[model samples]
Target chain A: MAISEPIVLPHATDEVRLARTWAQPRGFWGWFMNVHHTAIGVRFMVTSFIFFLLGGVLAAMIRLQLSRPENHAIGPDLYNQIFTIHGSTMIFLFAVPMMFQGFGVYVVPLICGTRNIAFPRLNAFSYYIYVVGGLLLWVGLFLKTGADAGWFAYTPLSGPQFTPGKRSDFWAQMITFTEVSALGVAICLATTILRQRAPGMTLNRMPIILWEKLVLSFMVIFAMPAVMVVSSMLLMDRTINTQFFNPANGGDVLLYQHLFWFFGHPEVYIIFLPGAAIVSTLVPVFARRHIFGHLAIVTSVVATGFLGFGVWVHHMFATGIPQMSASFFTAATLMIVLPTAVQFYCWIATIWNGRLQMKLPMLWVFGFFFVFLIGGLSGVMLASVPVDWQVHDTFFVVAHFHYVLIGGALFPMFAGLYYWVPKITGRMMNDLLGKVHFWLFFIGFNMTFFTMHFLGLRGMPRRVYTYPPEMHWGGLNMLASVGALFMAAGLIVFIVNFFQSKARGTLAGPNPWAAGSLEWATSSPPPDYNFTELFTVNGREPLWDNAPNQPIVSGVRDDIPEVLITNSLDSEPQHKDEMPGASIWPFLTSITVSIAFIWSIFSPWGIAYGAIPVVITLIGWLWPRGHSPAPRQPALEGRWSK
Target chain B: MAELEHTVRKGEAPALIWWCMFGGPFAWACDLGFSYVLEQHTCSTGHHYVLHVITVVCAIIALTGLAAGMAAYKRVPEEANDHGVRPMDRTHFQILFGMVFSIAFTIVIIAEAVPRWILHPCQ
Candidate 1:
């Protein structure tokens, strides 16, 4: 085959074949060392889903134990472990990894019209570290010491004097592992979104999903640090008796709350924004039109990111703070709702005007609107200092967040799965089964969480394993427990539908849903290099435009996995960035980091000695490859300061 | 709306963006955080009035700096390319993103000072 010229290259199918030959890894060890965004993305989805199931099972156990008054279904000690693990696993392992890392990795490159994510090895390292982090938590659980001080891991309760042993250490270490993973990917994504977008896919013309992701990536950059600080502080206090949280040593408990909520509050947006992105991506496709308020939505997403940081204190309102301090948070929290409301209204406006095609994905969008709205309203109620005083630690708070997490994250997740699984697996999910899954899950979800609001309002405290029959709370608790069963049944239906559809569902070609995004402009489960010929996107929906096959972005060297680095605003091609080929270094580095984290749990000195392998592995990893041209200095100026 | 931009030195756009992203939030955090620190320090050290006046001045300065940055960010044009790197493409929206929060931060700082004005320091 002839090397085609940059301007008029065609024959995408031929290029696909050539790209595959160079891009695809071979067997066994090759798969482990693969750095392709798609491969790593699929792994993230799989791992997070497995963790989701594990977390769900723990949830079911909790509900089962609490179903009957004075039930001995599970002891309090084990129950504490279960609840803590469930929250930690779902938030850290399932929600953030699955939403931000998995979805962002898979779609951002394709949408940006790049061959692979920037820093591909770092991407792989993030995944491996996440896997290790998740596994360590579950392993600790099996040993019956899975961070029993709650997901927040609040002080004094989680302080050295009260909780001993490796339980809290595991929680802190697991957090370090996951956060390092999240932060690494945040950098990868920020670089990719900022630099690798195709020519003409300018800032304003870029899709809403990309904007949401850019903001979320930056959020991960800034927000994840606070948690790491708190977690490490807690670990130091426990292991070395630093007394960061101990009142006797001048460290304040509220300081922990301040730091934790600083990260914890944005953590909610970190998880929720991706779900909103999925909805933004799908709403136009399902509604049969371009979105309403495209610019407004983009601004709002970024605005939400900015405002999200200020409202952390709202979560700490229950702690005794001055009225004036609480009011500041209250105002910040209230202000954030405007941007969110803009997003919801824009979606509603788009769908109302669009030629509505209520497919499986759209159904979940509707579900998201309903459930997240309730959660949002409850959140508003909680934002008020006085209302939060009553329901801060109650099941009402439980009801609110489930509405947020399940409705906000999971509902959109399933929608995105239905929307993208075909582009992933080349098969449409079963429509009938999808509907059954949605309805069952939706009904069961409402039944389970909504009842908790009443149970909480009726004076039932949270984190308790059992309640007395005389409390008259058995009825609501029982109802809530039964609702969990329905949700489980619904989930089972989904699992069957998902698996069955993968092998037997109807075939989906390049654009099954007639979506306008760039991802669908190629084969259903696009080839190893994603696009055969990258497009110079002229508008938000390039495929929706009248051009029959848009112009291609050439000049990327196919032999070496080259990608075009473009200007952020106009997406004008800057230069070619060579994507690193698959290597075992990232995997090795993950092990090095994991060993450091695990050892630090027992002795702080492990971090120092651990730095040896880490530094060695990092040297090997960052060492410039032998293939590239040496850096060209201006003229012959080898000496510093000519 | 027309996409507007201004020419920048080679690497200044990213710095501008970094400021645009964090300036407002940091301002608000400082106000909130300083208030927490000042509230404790003043109450303990018996200088509540001085602490209150000091926080108000610092917040005003931070607010002005954030405001000035937002103005510069808004002026970044879509066509502004430092060499071939066009970090200014989304500068307007990013400015708006940060500006809204800057306003919110102004509110937060003002809000943070409310207790310093109305309430007794520690007793």
Candidate 2:
């Protein structure tokens, strides 16, 4: 077991050994047992995309029902359920999972030059939990027990007294499921970024996307707890006779508002920052240069994270808080604009300084700029208490958030998918099809959301099942519905291109985009081992800066799932650690947890009964096998001996 | 044992750097949370002045963080413009980022305070 200097093997033999050692189990049971980050990441993306389509169908139904004044296309009761599930699915199931969890899980470890994500089994467990959570909500919808109390599920309305049944209960427990999943992935991503970076990839050399993801993980840690707590309290009040939101029991309704918004405001950043990270990542590669003002962009991201938490009160402005409180929130909301503007300026400067290539991915970036800018401008107006008071609960407010969420998260998400699909699938998507997808989406998105501003200004209220013909809202609503059709068409084209490219598109080499990050340094559709020889970088754009002869880190055993752990700041290698391989316990544990969560809606004793199996499954998941390899001696004697 | 020596040789980030990086945000968070909670008291007791005092104290604390960042920056001035992967470059980046964050949060604190001066607490 004496540590010897790593001897280089023939490339062919090294590939074979690495492949053999890192191979996943085969067939059906193996799929459930898989814990590789890339596999789990793909599962997250595919599952969330299915939820996205389901959510889209719900949106289209809402549009059809409202296409004409007093349209009776959908009954009011079902309409209530449709809109509620639509909002919840889009925000909770699709956006966060796709933007933050899916992309983060897939790309972060690769970009950091690690063998696998830290806590790979937990990553796998998170994917299953997310799937089950999504199924619970959609199943409830199909079963006619869907949550009808809107996405936020504000108390009194969602309480047992007003909207009885298990509808709101389903919503509360779904939040618990997704939050638990999100928190798990957050810990995995944050730890991978902080401790498992390639040796010498110091903080200064870290990519902008890594910085953004790190900040995002921290935001998730701080913000998600508030939502989980409030949701649990809502459930307690409904099932267990607690009075957290019961005004007659001396429980203030405003308490729910305060707690929910604390998580809710930062949740916007939780979704948007990952989108911003995509833009930051794409700009440098397309512009063909190192990003301008790298430190400033990183600083702006951190500032945005902090400022985001302070502005939640603005969402509560029309609820009649004191003028001083309103003023503080208004100012905080306005202040958040500065950091986002700084990021925008840096992106523009980077493009200005370098030769801009309008690749397909870059085209989606342009779309994001147009759509997100309009959304952001409208948001500044909404920040003012007077303007918000006028537009409160109007179609105008509806228009504002759609512009923000769709433009900010969805647009950048499509950009990232286009940019990384080659690396994930080892094939290039059809360029003509991608362009068509972009134009239809861009045009249709503007047609649908921009018209809502007018409808809102005309006094059309949101969440109402129908409007009278005299309201004069028919023409605009019709136009918006037509736009939804076009957006739907664009999504169809994207789906066709995605699968078609995977099977028959041009074979993509390791660096299809000729990008500069570490992920590009490895093969497209990277091998299970990630890299035959781990990389050691000297600069941010390692491929471009170190080029042709970038240093390779050797000595981490190719026989076991060993990853090099490094110091946090400097990334100086410290010791080697083993990573867990594929297992079925994560899958089993998720089922146990899901059964408990779903059962609790019916009986209070479900939790008490559920904890036993959960504990047993968790024990199985955590139990260590009695096997240990002899420790290797230090490779570099002087460095190890101090 | 040898790996332990290697880890020891890597050293640790100075506490001043962590304080400089995070202290300003911690203060701003305190200002927001406390100000929000204290609003109920201010409205009931007619003591609007308490909010202004809290804002002033929080702003001062944020300013101290800015000063600490500046002090750290001055020590690594040679690496200020460098974005290399050296140890000094990493320190320089952290110091610069902390300074920018401190300045940004300080501005936010002051802007938040302005609303307190112009409007009555209970209005």
Candidate 3:
């Protein structure tokens, strides 16, 4: 039955009329001002892609400089600032947001049988805050006050006395803005997963993606707070002369290290988990079966979140922390590999059992396995208290992280983008172009980062603005620079491919991937309310398992907007739960939050002044003065109505 | 709004409100219980016996208030189904389990703290 059909109801209620009246916006400007998750998600992807190109350009510059010892391709000051922003932008502003939150916000609720993200306004707020925060750092670079102390933005070096400008503040404030945005989305995403499973989709029945997000959300909750606390302290020290990291004021620099790494190490897992989620989603589809050891996989993800916090001290092996504590962290770090191994083994077993399609996404998965393995192994070596003290600040550490982050995160993000582009844009990205982009990127990435391990092994220290000649590292450095160009070329291809596909690409059907997730059950580029009918699940793959017998209750009028409440254990009708209608309050509230943060960065009084607008906006959001939502229609017809 | 007309019984509102009024003390007791345990491990100089006693009393009052709040919900048991137990049975178990765990954890904290408190008197 088409939703457009007009039905004469036996009795029409005010609720039905109200629901119909609240139908999603239709005009061009409505889309321009859209708060829908789909549009917001596209914004996140497009923005992150732009940053990716920017970060790639930075990567090429670093490679060119490092290609030869004593190379003056770019001066040390410029080189340091370039790499700092590149790493910070890629990790903080680009990869994690684009891969996890962007993908999670747009897809999780749709997959889990909810109308929207738990907090729609907060989601929108996060998007805008990210844009403004990202621009702040870029603007600094444009203004030639680029931060040069490295992405970590370590204390004393990054302190006001040394940095002498708002350079470190740019990095610190960006961290504050991005982490706050991430923490908000994490809470929103986590709460949605816990409370809003589709009926019949018990904890056991949840897709691994939801479980992965749940774990990652908790990680963000614990990990981001540490950064927020530390960065705020750093900001305070800079602006207000707080003694948090000031030795003259009896402060310890080690405190900053403790707090930062407390966030930093777990952040690696935070990024990796979402990639794991995407792989979990795609791997099972290609395998043509339920994921192997679903319960065990969820357990591993949860354990990894807990263990990620314990291993932060490994990043500080040379900081001269107590020997026992260092050993304990090393042991903890090594222990975390068990859970990661558990997930890896499960993926392998899943593929081994089922017919594997060597598609583009799958190819990236294979690449992740190879690249991430080497990275993980190197990381495990670093986790050893003894070995790490030797290579603590060398290029080896750089290689190890890049392998994991790039192999673990970037490869999977590309695969996921390609895998979901059809569903997101309602069009297929050109597979030939995608494959070409992948190979060039894959080859270029390896060429650039792989040789850094040897460079480090030969005692080439990292963060040196320039290296002296006769270091015997000129050849490898030059080779790295040449390799960076390939990466640049690949990024260019990806950019062209992305825009080209957006303008003209094959129209994708709802389930282009022939996968069984709920997001695929709806139209590609899903409707505002997401599902047409609220679906009840009988098994893991509802569309596949139930097929013609898919359980759907009918009788709801399409005119009334209503949310279905399913039985938590089994997807069954409970009641209609209507959410508050959209208001301009969230946007207004976020503006206040941003004002407070930006002001606080500049002046202490900014916090005092900013809190007023924040309180006002928050009150407006919580005060229920909106029109009563549309009435509940009969369950069956309503399921498919949205 | 009309459909949301279901309200508490005529005499129930005041009692429910009074029960809710005890929430502060209940919260205080839980806080003391957690802190008392931690203090027992960390503090070597002084024992906080009065604090522990006060915390336990508050926790008991809190538990009572919680029970009263639950009573206000006033659910009834219905017939059993093929699922093997009545829904009421599950509800009862949930309520019982929650109360038991809450009280038990509080008592466990007190139990450990009291022993340490006796052994190490206030300086």
What i-RMS does each candidate reach, in Å?
Answer: 7.1, 4.8, 11.6
Regions of model 1 farther than 4 Å from truth: A1-17, A629-642, B1-31, B40-123
Write the residue-wise lDDT of candidate 2 on A177-215 in tens digits.
999999999999999999999866788778989999999
Of the pair 2 and 3, which is ahead by lDDT? 2
True contacts kept of each: 0.20, 0.81, 0.00
Ranking by TM-score: 2, 1, 3
At residue B87, give the lDDT of candidate 3: 27
Reference-based lDDT, residue A68, model 1:
86
Query: Which ranges of candidate 2 are over 4 A from the true structure?
Result: A1-13, A629-642, B1-12, B77-82
Please name the candidate that would achieve the greatest TM-score relative to the true structure: 2
Per-residue accuracy of model 1 over A12-37 as CA lDDT, tens digit each = 33574557544767899898789999
Question: For each candidate, what's the DockQ?
Answer: 0.23, 0.51, 0.04
Q: What is the CA-based DockQ of model 1?
A: 0.23
Order of candidate numbers by DockQ, starting with the best: 2, 1, 3
